[model samples]
Target: GEAMDRRRSCGVADAVCDATDASCTEGAPEVVQTTRLYAGAIGQATAHLAETRLSWESQPRNIAIFLRRATKELIEPFEMLRDWLVSRYGVRIFVDPAAAEELVPGEATWTPEQRPHLADMIDLIITMGGDGTLLFVSSLFERSVPPVVAFNFGSLGFLTTWDFGKFRSSLTRIFEDQSHLNLRRRLHVTVVQFDEGDRPSQVSEYQVLNEVVVDRGSSPYMAGIDAYVDSQYCTTVAADGVILSTPTGSTAYSLSAGGPMVHPAVTGVLFTPISPHSLSFRPVVFPDRSVVRLQLPQSARGDAQVTLDGRVGPTLRPGDCVVVSISAFPLPCVAPLSDTHTWLASLATVLHWNDRRKQESLTSASYTETIAAARRAGEAEQAIDGGAREDGAVFDSSPTASESLDDRKTADRRRGTRRDRDKAAADGTVARSPAVARRPRHRRRAAAMEQAPELACAETIDDIESFMRHA
Candidate 1:
């Protein structure tokens, strides 16, 4: 009603033409329109001022909805968003071929394709699944990708941080040019395959949000991969495989393969080896501009397989190589306003990075309680023992000291008995010298000393005085 009132008061409604008319194009002398308004009617396009970034002229009119799967759960939301977007704001929709039947009259179906100038065709990309769905969308456009707004539906939603519940408001903000965009770098990998003649046969290119892997798939023998950086020989990885990743992919397969977790904002490439046979083959970080290449030696026995973002690619023949570097166009993921720390939060939430059990804090109350408990324990021991000694030394008054003294007394008695038996035996039959008949007088006196009372050692001053007097 308000928009209609504004249109009526300015007489703009009188000049408005049928949005679906093929003759009425933006900047056409027939339309005579001052502002660039996107036509949301079927099979129609309006000119964009700013191409990809969110701005007044870059408002998303043709939004492509990509889902992780064609399940009922995702299809329902797809239809709901389609209805809400078209009915309220007259936004055109593009959907997957699987969900084409659910499209309304004005809404259109979208098919994924490998187009270079896709941004010129579509204004925005809205993904309704997990990070994998977003990766699939990223893989669609080789260059000039539109801004993507991803909603979390799958598990481990590190990349898909936006909630579907607040999608309406998010889309509103995006249309109003008020939403924040998290731009993540992607790796562009080109694989050049060679034939037996050592000549280039085929070249395949891919855009990966995660790591590109070259591994010995199902092969018992180790893979011998020669790695290089910017045309300089780096090292040969003799292991299961090697992974080249972007900083955005650092936390993914590369990290699992013993690669360092580089921040997404960092402009670097990660070279990680998977179970390398050599102990010295460690993960290395190369500049973003540096082109890292992985190749199989010509003397290789088995072919090494290549995988880009978990999708299997062509096997690399002997002398074949893969070139990896930063992509030209970065992926603009829609996140919360000022939520640049979402990646850090994902590290803690999803990956459980640096997660540890919190230790007990030492507070004054706890310390005092511990001291009181120790004092009470000492008091209980004192009650059991009758009283403590006046000596300042702890070992002297402790029960352990008394128990040890008893042990010494018992030991002395055993020694005395053994000596007395050995002496009494005529043939020295008590496991002693067989030739000895009787022991010496000094030996007998020593045995008597060993058989003395618990106070024999004069452990205390009073015991010493009493022993001297008795002697």
Candidate 2:
């Protein structure tokens, strides 16, 4: 039988046969019941037309590092992903704040100026830590957001779509053919404090990718939250906290709070309560373009905690309010090659979520076994990196001592030259004579080297100059 679609009017008219399929010729066209199907389709089309379109742009060669500062269990997966990225893309990885020291042991001894530029030049940002670490790194970007691929090694990963085992394959797919695969959506938030009359003040704006949670912190009673949708009073929530999450955050704290699981590609926001005292206080999904305003009652007994994504926000006073809306710019994330539905299905399969049999299987995998597997994976990736290079030049620590000494001497000489130039400039003296400028600091050292015929070193001044320049 052919599917028959029907249309109905909300108030003005009755059900009508919108369309018919000849495949069901034996029976009359089935009159389905829906609210103005054609009109709904038209409206949806117009809305999408008005919404900002996204571009799939090319990304530069960049390396991704999985951060693991928030949780201990995340370290194993992070190391695995790091090794895999380095092996496949030849991209250097940087760990989180706490692990950075161990990952680059010599960084502590090096001056800030002498530190390698790779840290700042890292193109891709990946965080294996919880949402907190992801939020922390996102805030680090002053202007533009770098593509961040988060792998959730924590209890929740609403923003993170990939797990440890599948991440390597997903990443390889992204690097193949130099394609950019992530999609990002950002939220524009405005912090507000009303005047004596409750008028909102226009202030600075910020963009977040995950969610913004407002909560009453450490109080005996629930905070009174008054919500408004585009100036229309929505409801008053008597709860410990309220969460406004993006589609990327639907599976995070929002899910724990009883919110519906929304796919990442869905353009909408989820509003869920942390713990609502009333049964009617269920989670609600709003249109992506809707503006949500949250204000605490002036007569409330305590203050509330407001967090953006996971970064800390100012305490919400009784009369303070926050305005949240879809940001003009979205945080572009590289989605693993799999479509959103496939990723969701894989998440269910890997996490053994919502299924008893799968949960039992997940429980069967021991923590120690997982760690061992991660380590083995990392070692294998290192081997891959060792073999990937065309030229077999390997970096060894044998010459490190000599290299450091030479670097120090060269640095000292540069500092001396800079000081001499500054002193001359401050004194308003004329430029140095050519002979003085060309004078060598180690005349005795040069003489000694020249006298040693068996030194196997060049005696030419030009040769010495060339060596110094190269150093």
Candidate 3:
């Protein structure tokens, strides 16, 4: 098994695996405009966002507030922000009912059911939590989501870029329409039911901000599932499950499942298997217009369930399937800037992408000697800047100059090397000789503090599933 472990022909041969998935179909339908968001516990993959600069006319009127929890630590700040928005901008504020069981007196609240009526009424949505908060907001408004400003309060805040400490100033700029926006697209997914006659009925439709997962539930046996691309049978998945991800979800579950890190700006879909049975069955990426379907094989032993984002959905009976495609309505998320660096920034802070320890080249003979040499150089420079050291230490103890060349030639003529040394020895005033010049040290590229982080509270991981349940 160890020798057979390889990435040879990982994904389906015909599967699209473009690193920069920029090309779209010529006949692709026009993309819809809406608010976008990032969601998931560990976060999910994402696609390219439609960039837009906020204008004066685009300023939000009625804003909605969402929180990770309603604890004192979370609610107090919400109150202050709500008061400030109402007094300064005179904007109406609405809150999510889930965030607070009992709303503050006189404060308005909203639910996902009101999205249709409140879509226009709520001009801006502000969420404080991890990326999950943003995804919950996405689930609220299936279509035409208002621009959203997400604050980071979760463990890994890739999607929630802004800091809570600077929320006031950030909101000021946002309200002034000086902020940039990235309109992200979500996966439009539908769970359809099938009867024994092969007739199918739509069970539920959802706009998923992250990846859609279909995996074996609590069953002990590995489930066999069939996959389709553009309605064509592609391959069968024999594993815990399979994932269909949006570009936005590329960072979340898709990444964890060994899928490529498709940029949120690079519009595409990802297919990643979870604990796959076949070694060659690898993750795949498809163009934006591509439609994928995952079905259960009739020979499967048990039922598999679908999980949208991180939330569990309907169960998959033997014949049922899930259809996934690019959503026409893209979510417009408020961004700090309109540049590619934002994606790079997220990778750096969240994933520490490409971060590594730099190697050091020791030009000196030994590490201790190198350290001593550096210390001497620093001391010499300090002595020059100031007066001499308090200890009056000598910089170099070697002779300043060698015996004159003419004198050495005269000595050589008078006597050979040994006799010359004997004459100098007899004279008692030995002629001093110069030492060879030392080679200049190469510039040190690394600092002393540049070291790999030390592990803390290094406990042995007993069991991942049990640990998660307890956590």
lDDT of each: 0.67, 0.58, 0.68
Candidate 1 per-residue lDDT over residues 101-126, each given as its tens digit: 54332446644552443555566778
Return the clash pairs for model 2, or none.
181-335, 182-333, 182-334, 182-335, 183-333, 184-331, 184-332, 186-330
Taking all chains together, each candidate's TM-score versus the true structure is 0.65, 0.52, 0.67
RMSD of each: 13.8, 26.9, 21.2
Q: Write the per-residue lDDT of candidate 3 for residues 331-396, one digit (tens) a residue.
A: 667778773667789999889999997665666357667687677656644534464233323333
Q: Per-residue alpha-carbon lDDT of model 2 for 1-471, expressed as tens digits?
A: 122211111110111111222232235564332211111121123222112221212333455464555455555665566566666667555444455565433211223452233223555567666566676665554333445666676555645666667776766554443223334455678888666787765454666777899898777888789999999999988988899998767766787788887766677878998889898888989998799999898898898887887778877777888899875444545554433554566468645567763334544657667777777655643543343233333333232222356644554564455454455455543223334446575663355355333433756655544543343
> Model 2 misses residue 55 by how many Å?
11
Better by TM-score, candidate 3 or 2: 3
lDDT-superior candidate, 1 or 2: 1
* Top candidate by TM-score: 3
Clashes per candidate, residues 3 or more apart or on different chains: 0, 8, 22
Ten contiguous residues minimizing lDDT sum, candidate 1: 42-51
Per-residue lDDT, model 3, residue 290, is 91
